[model samples]
Target: MDKILINVLKEVQDNDGYISEKAMKNISVKYNVPLAKLYGVATFYAMFKIEKQGEHIIEICGSPSCMLNNGQKIEDFLEKELKIEVGKTTKNKKFSLYKTSCIGCCDEAPAMLMDGKPYTNLTIEKIKKILKKY
Candidate 1:
């Protein structure tokens, strides 16, 4: 049942871009699940977004390895360059920034997931170039 609930949530998020309060109610009624339970599941997973996101989502790695390799520096750069704080979308809606746990690129460190594509071994210069293309 947990797997089924997660799958349904994933499908809804994929189709709707985010999980809205109305959707949660619908899911609750349809599945006969408690709203709190559904909300808990959605919030527990990093992949589930409760708010609308920008065209490009930038999830900075917050692992110790990434931090040691200057991930904090990269995150600061992204916040400045994008002119928006983490967990927010830019005014132009072109990008959104977030801090997430390791993306399984500890080997590369300083890594991030942009629209689910991994960008590794980051530096300010490399990120500037990457943002330009996006």
Candidate 2:
């Protein structure tokens, strides 16, 4: 059941960019699992998104290594440029900014995942350039 739930949630995420509350309830009814249980599964996993996201996602790492490498500066730059805080999507729904612990790029220290593609050794100039591409 857990596997099925994960698969279904992934499908919803792939199609909707999030798992809407209505969808969760529908899945609960179909699977005979409590709504709370479904939500638990969703929230427990970092991959599952409950709220709405944008067309593009920017996930910046906040691990110790990243923090030491001016990761906060990168986050600040993104917030200023996008005018949205972490866990928020742009008003136009074009981009979303998020923070994560580690992305297995500790060797690079400061790193980010833009739409699931890794960008390492981030700098303000580089981030601005990357945003332009998106």
Candidate 3:
């Protein structure tokens, strides 16, 4: 990581893995980077979490291609099985669900990413197995 990013990570670590607006502003000023640029970087990558994530981050691809298949079904299954809505963390804080645009693997429609690892061509059974691994 860059010095600036290391500093940012330290700051986030101090605040329970969440970067507050004030901290971001301070970083922008200290690093001489534009606030918009910092925010853009934070939002551009799925790995740079803005909010506090659970132990596991489950990202479902909901692009048109994925949706045309069984994306919705998979999403519904996750929500129902996890007992949490999209963008929400599980009650046990073990998982957080997010809907994302195409993860660049449309060939694997109805795919999901768990903590940055892509799992494609998912069925309920496969999803269950994947979750068990977590």
Alpha-carbon lDDT, every model: 0.94, 0.93, 0.83
Q: Where does the lowest 10-residue lDDT sum fall in candidate 1?
A: 45-54
Candidate 3 Cα deviation (angstroms), residue 71: 0.2
Candidate ranking (TM-score, best to worst): 2, 1, 3
Q: Give lDDT for model 1.
A: 0.94
Top lDDT: which candidate number?
A: 1
Q: Per-residue CA lDDT of candidate 1, range 66-129, in tens? A: 9999999999999999999998999888998999998999999899999999999999999999
For all predicted structures, in order, the TM-scores are 0.85, 0.87, 0.69
Residue-level lDDT tens digits of model 2 in 1-134:
89999999999988988999999999999999999999999999988889898889999998999999999999999999999999889999999999998999999979999999999999999998998998
Q: What are the RMSDs of all candidates, in order?
A: 1.9, 1.7, 4.6
Q: Model 2: which residue pairs collide? A: none
Give model 1 RMSD, 1 decimal.
1.9
Q: Show where candidate 1 strays beyond 4 Å.
A: none
Q: Residue 22 of candidate 2: its Cα lDDT?
A: 98
